[model samples]
Target: MSLKSTVIFLLSLITVMAKAQIDTAKIKSYADQVMVRVNIDTNIERYVFTEGPEDKPLETILSINNKTRASFSVDYKIISGTVSFTPNFLPGNNDNELKGSSSYADFRFRFFPKKIIQTVYYKKVKGFYIENMQDFFPEWKEGKDAYLQFPDLKIQSFGGSTAYVMKKDFSLKSIYTQGEWQKESRGSWVPVIDYDLSIFTDIIDGRKNRDTQYSIGASMGYFYNWVLGKKNRVNIAPNVGLGLGGMFSSTRDILDDGTKSSKENTQYLTIRFATGLHIGYNTDRLLFGGKFNVTSSAYNEKGNQNVQNNNLYGLIYIGYRFPPPGVVKRNYDKIQKKIPIL
Candidate 1:
């Protein structure tokens, strides 16, 4: 389906489930409060391509120079939104002398409707350099060598995921957004369907080229939230998912003579894996946590070529919850009456 149709379908499903109830015995709801959070993270995006024989393969890894990001988030009722950007002033983020400069931005929104979780996000990244220059050049030294850089390469992605919790007692929100607190240890088998549309642009040999890719996948994820502490204020959650999908890509190349080449379309099968762990301390008014997560996907190209995209990140966050202002609550209630899914 098209991106617009998928979004409409998800919104319709959420509208239907908006009025559904939650199990209050196993989870504590903080819908009446507004939660605000600040997060600092090291989220690195890398793409690795390998070709040649299985015994002896040639690999090229491309990654951005910026290594640290900061984000601000707000949660109210069942809605949450976050905006993140690379902070160049941080320690490892400003190494432009060795690696070329890069820019990154991400915007995300999430909704919790009863047993369902829906997320939508947009991400943009520009500028990449070959991270493993020594693998190809034996004489290349780490701090003393200048790696190959692609200053004109850019990637933009629009994506979302819809997930369903099978166990009513398990609270995924407690681990994800901290909008709810689980009273006891519980686990669930959550099924997810995700889709994305990505566009890649680069300048090669004085010519501009662009590739667009559309992908959809379905996965079964297992999540466990282990509650501890005498006051049930501490929790540990671990989750993993495995899935398969397909990527359909169309490429266009601009000739050096200022003519546009015909678009070429290709298809490939993709395998994806995701794993994460979260440890947090939550109280009535405050919460603090740290998390580590990794997501990877691989696909094979023609002529014995394989490509993989890996996203690895570690994050620390602190949040506070308080009652919403009267004006804000009233305005949100009025809007919710019309949309119902808000």
Candidate 2:
């Protein structure tokens, strides 16, 4: 039992099994150096106070990268912005004709985490329309040359939400949106004895009407960061938000003896708001941005009805910042907490 004490205990058990197999191959080469990025965004939504003729925006977005927080992100959305009206209804001294716009491509789910981060969402939207239908059916417009002309309409939506974030910028958002909207076009107001004042058209046949909505909301936001020059990374952020919620609406129309007239699903009370102005330019491997946003929604159903919708958008982004995946830090500089969130 003495061959140099068994060769120094077999060389201290082969130096502890070669330092535990070189720390399990540096933790499998730091989980195969994980670092992923992908993003695409395009937007357009504006009301600006509403007036008429001006519509074209279907919203499109795609993103990925939450490798446990790369500024957080996991979103995918496709929106059918809005605009459609063929011959739904017109009677108050008519004049209607203008059909060339429609959209539909439902599918939405979001989890945008930075810039005050924290957001969870779900949506199932469908063909949205109605921006300034003569400021909401002013008897289908009478005065100004009896205005009314919208084509192709059908809207639907589904929803879900959860949000919470603190300090790292500040944000609190909650949401839920249910939907169903429709449009119909038939004939009305007879008068063609021998006096030109034509007002009746349905190009390819039509008759459909529906409106239903369910909403919930909550908002509170703030973001502040102004780093510029001198390797400060040139970044600027400004944000604001407000919220209130309640909405339940239903309206169905179709009656000329075929009997079908509904409009009792009322439960309104809503207010939502948003504002943003952000600019970015980070390096270590590119990251650029230019964002300008303003949004609002107000609805108070009942006598003297009050409805409001205002949205303005602008967003351009380009990203790529992968260079930090190299570890096994040989004791990670004697361990000093470097974002290993666990």
Candidate 3:
């Protein structure tokens, strides 16, 4: 062949070789993929994950609410497998799942961190809880010295009850919870103290030596409640309790306007101090003859014993009581004749 013909023939052969290489790679790329699985830590909050001994990191395909989905063609690359997420959700199907849902139908796509997957954990930020207020008072009228395994979820509650608690007026003052519910054995709303350890910067200036001084505090709380008195009829409801680590870091930050930015970057800690009385009652549940405690608070700080100064916490509950089911009116004339105080 002439010089030009020889060059053209070589180029044609090179093109054919490149095409064969592409075709071969495509045929072998997906033959050894593996199936994906999931591990759950419902208690932990910030969703995290990891890879197992015989596994690789999953590429997140979706993440919303308490669900997540990750995709990986690597299954086809290794064990030739496919990924399908099955969610334990309510009211929906594969074809018509909810938008932005972590349900079975729509959780197959999530944003995954590009790295080796570790065991997934949740990030705990905030929750509602209750306080077991009976310990401090041994003479409580009802259910004194009782502790039901701390409440995990509180449906509704009232801070104090006349039938189940000691005196209508308790010296224990108030019961506070860090989370949402308190302890009532048979009632569904057992109180649980949830942690809402938040991160923020604050600037506060308070002179503690005097009662007139002011201090700013940020508190997190949980919610729970129980059935009171008449067998699931009346609710001693919506017990809300919270604990802020004694480390009440407060600050004053303002940007041009009077708005302040309370953002802090420090090692976070939630220290429990001074078992104070917690009294907060919502109007909806406390409508006995009238409403009860609009709000109640207590806080204690570490100080010198010589100072002899401490914040005094008090009790204030406003509610009405109904007569028991068997209560009957007496005949005034006959009763007065038998025992007359006049």
Candidate-wise lDDT, in order: 0.90, 0.37, 0.25
Per residue, candidate 3 scores C-alpha lDDT tens digits across 265-330 of 222233221212133332222321111222222332233111111112233333322221222223
User: TM-scores of all models?
Assistant: 0.92, 0.25, 0.18
Better of 1 and 2 by lDDT: 1
Ranking by TM-score: 1, 2, 3
Task: Residues 78-137, candidate 1: write the lDDT tens digits.
Answer: 999999988777889888888989999999999998899999999999999999999989
On lDDT, the candidate that comes out on top is 1
Prediction 2 global C-alpha lDDT: 0.37
Clashes of each: 0, 7, 73
lDDT of 2 by residue, 1-342 (tens): 863564355345434433332211100111112122332233333223222323632221211110010122221111112221222232311222221233223233433333222222332212223334445565554334422333433333445444444432221111110010001111111111111111111222355565666677666544333345765455454555567777666666655566777665667777776655566654545556666666677774444344565545555555443433245334443342563421
Off by over 4 Å in 1: 1-25
